[model samples]
Target: MKISAVVVTFNRKKLLLECLNALRNQTYPLDAIFIIDGPSTDGTPEALLECGYIKELPPKKGNWSWETKNVIYSPINNKPIKVYYVRLYKDVGGSGGFYEGVKRAYEEGYNWIWLMDDDAEPREDALEKLIRYMNLPGVIALAPTVIRPTGEISKPHRGILCFKKIFPMIQIPLDESKYKSNQPVQIDFVSFVGPLIKRDAIKIVGFPKKEFFIHHDDVEYSIRLRTVGKIYLIPDSVIIHKENIKKTSLIKKRFLGKTIYRIPYNKLWKTYYGTRNLTYLGRIYSKSKFKFYFKLLKRWAVSVGAIILFDDHKIKRIQFITSAYLDGLRGKFDNEKPKRILYGGKKE
Candidate 1:
């Protein structure tokens, strides 16, 4: 099988290098590596060319939205692997990068495309093990165990999908007992991080919706893939989620008895996209139109209440989410706004 690895990166140059090195050291041979760089200003492009890890591979093409560069890395099998790097001119988030990378890899005759973020470092045997499950009956896409850098584990592969009580969402528990071996187990959802997906799956269900922008795009894509085939979680296949280790997001007290938290104004952009995308998904997968509208109102009421009670810049949060709700209703999406760093009520 012609295997290609796709990594999407922004300004995280340091971690991006580590991730590329990890990919180069994989036990399974990758035919090519496709990097979708978001035109990072941190000298990421120059760093890739002058990467200290690999030697002497040079760029032989003109720079463009998709610049192709050659990378030389030696595998334990005593062969040099040539990897391809593509830098994107536009910053299209993770979703857009995957859409482009997957499309190109498919067009270039790759049988399988392994998708990952710049911060996801896979174990040596990850690709080898994931490839073992592809030909199994009904297997469509495969992914690895996602562990935090601290070794705290998360199962991106196995998840419960629900659209009944509230919005379209996932319920997850990283139960070790459920994964006793490297045997492939079918799953409801899986993230793009370290997932080895069949090109045929893309041909059938299509690439992820770049319109969702980032969050929930994977879930949305997985949902469509379910219509054609099964997605599997390989127990022994593992990758480290080095980026969001020990990260926390806004959580309402009513959900899990956790204390209500104050959300910063800058983070509201994420809320805008998540709210819009999930509502869009919920509208699509909801049981009925009446149920969808009822849940939508309940969602707004609860969200507005939480913002008023715990968050700062309450009016702006309301405005942002309200705009998101309307946009989602009208099926509109784009790069909303550039993130602005705020400190002590002052924009940086």
Candidate 2:
């Protein structure tokens, strides 16, 4: 099989190198590795060149361009892995990087595309285990169990999206016991971490929505993927996610025996994109307009309450949240507003 891997990276050069090294040592070798650079300013290009990963830096071709380089895996093994380095003019976020990477891999006629971020390093046998399930009946994509460096399962990386009344559209992480015997557990949602997706599936659902910029891009993509075939979580196939855990900025309160997380003022910028994207998804998935708007109103009320009770920068946060909900309802997709709000930069 023509198996290729796609890695999306931003400003983290060290993490990207670790991820690439892990890819280099995979038990089941890959034919190519696509590096989607988010036009990083952290000397990532120079570092890659220093490591002999790429012979030359790719020229900027307008806003987006790519250059291909071939480097032998090692002097002893002498396996060649083609590396395609794609450079963007600006940081369009991981969603845009994956969109570009997947499109290129598909166009190159790769049978399967392994997708991940620069922070994720797969186990040596991860790809081999996933390859074993390629012929499984009606399987379109397979994901490895993602674990933090501390060996705890990363809950958000693999889950089943629940649409029940109690937890509507919430993602429930799979129980470890279910896949403990090395069995593949069927799941409706998986993140971009080490998921091997078949080219045929991409042909049907198309590439990921690039406008998402930062959040919930995987959920939206996974929802579309469910229309084609099953997505499985392989327990034995593991990847270590090395993302630095940030300190929680949200206030947590137990209400009615449920923990409610309230967004803080500083994190409102992120909340905007997440709220907008999720609201957009709800708009697409909800059967009734009344229910959709009702749910949206509840969310807005919660935001207002959070601002009033536990947050600062009250007016600005509310304004951002309100704009998010409204833009989402109107299906207005772009990162211009959020950029202006966060960086005080004008839209291009």
Candidate 3:
């Protein structure tokens, strides 16, 4: 299959290099590699130039979109693989970067697209293992077991949201024994950390909601992808998530085998997107606006309270969340160019 590995990156040039190196050493042959670079002032552009790349595909004529012209090489067993570097005009957040990367891969006639954040580094055989299960019926996307550099398992994020409102995230271990073969286990959701996606599924579900800009975009996209086919976890396919240490919260068990987790909102940016996206999501999945509106107000109120109590810039946090709440409520979206956020530049 024609597989395109799409990596969305920001200002973390060092991390992006580690991620690209891991991908370059993949056991499976990579037909293409795309780096969807958000504008980085941290010498990322200079670093790319220093890496020695050639411009293979020029930007489309009469298009105001991001340019995808540069190329790098990955030599696998004495063969050079082409890698496409796509530089956006500005930082459009992770959502916009992924949307552009995936859309381009789909339009460029790739059969499958491998997705990941630039912070992640996959095992050499990760792509091969993910591809082993892609041909199975009812499987549209396959994800790798993500782990911290310390070898501890990272978050799997297979949560169901409709019934229990905001629930604690449940993570499953990456059991290598279960992956003795190419087994497909169904899941409710998976993060976009390291997943190989079928372009056919993208054709069916459409593009991800880039309006999300950052947090909850994957969760929302997973919900939409579930409509088409099952997303599977390939335990043998692993990736080292070279990410910041994730904070844990109080885990409270609930009825019907559900749990309520007190996951910490990283900062005001997370606070804004999580609450806004939750409010927006409630509107989309809820059968009744009357029912969703009550939940929305409750969540929004809790958001405001949380910001006032925890955030350093409480007032500004509240303002950002309030804008997101209102916009989400009104079903407003303008992803062509995101308005300049007041704080915390752009997120991944």
Best by lDDT, which number? 2
Those runs of model 2 whose alpha carbons end farther than 4 Å from true positions after fitting are 59-62, 74-77, 165-169, 248-267, 287-292, 342-348
lDDT against true structure, model 1: 0.75
- Per-candidate count of clashing residue pairs (backbone under 3 Å): 0, 0, 1
- How accurate locally, in lDDT, is each candidate? 0.75, 0.83, 0.71
TM-score of each: 0.86, 0.90, 0.79
- Candidate 1 residue-wise lDDT at 107: 88
Q: Could you report the Cα RMSD, in angstroms, for every candidate shown?
A: 4.3, 3.3, 6.4
**In model 1, which regions exceed 4 Å deviation?**
52-64, 166-168, 171-174, 245-259, 310-312, 337-348
TM-score of 2: 0.90
What lDDT score goes with residue 114 in model 3? 86
Model 1: ten consecutive residues of lowest lDDT: 338-347
Give the higher-lDDT candidate: 1 or 3: 1
Best by the TM-score measure: 2
Candidate 3 lDDT over 211-259, as tens digits, reads 8888778888888788898888777788888877544543343535655
Q: Scored by Cα lDDT, where does model 3 land?
A: 0.71
Ten-residue stretch with the least lDDT total in model 3:
166-175
Ranking by TM-score: 2, 1, 3
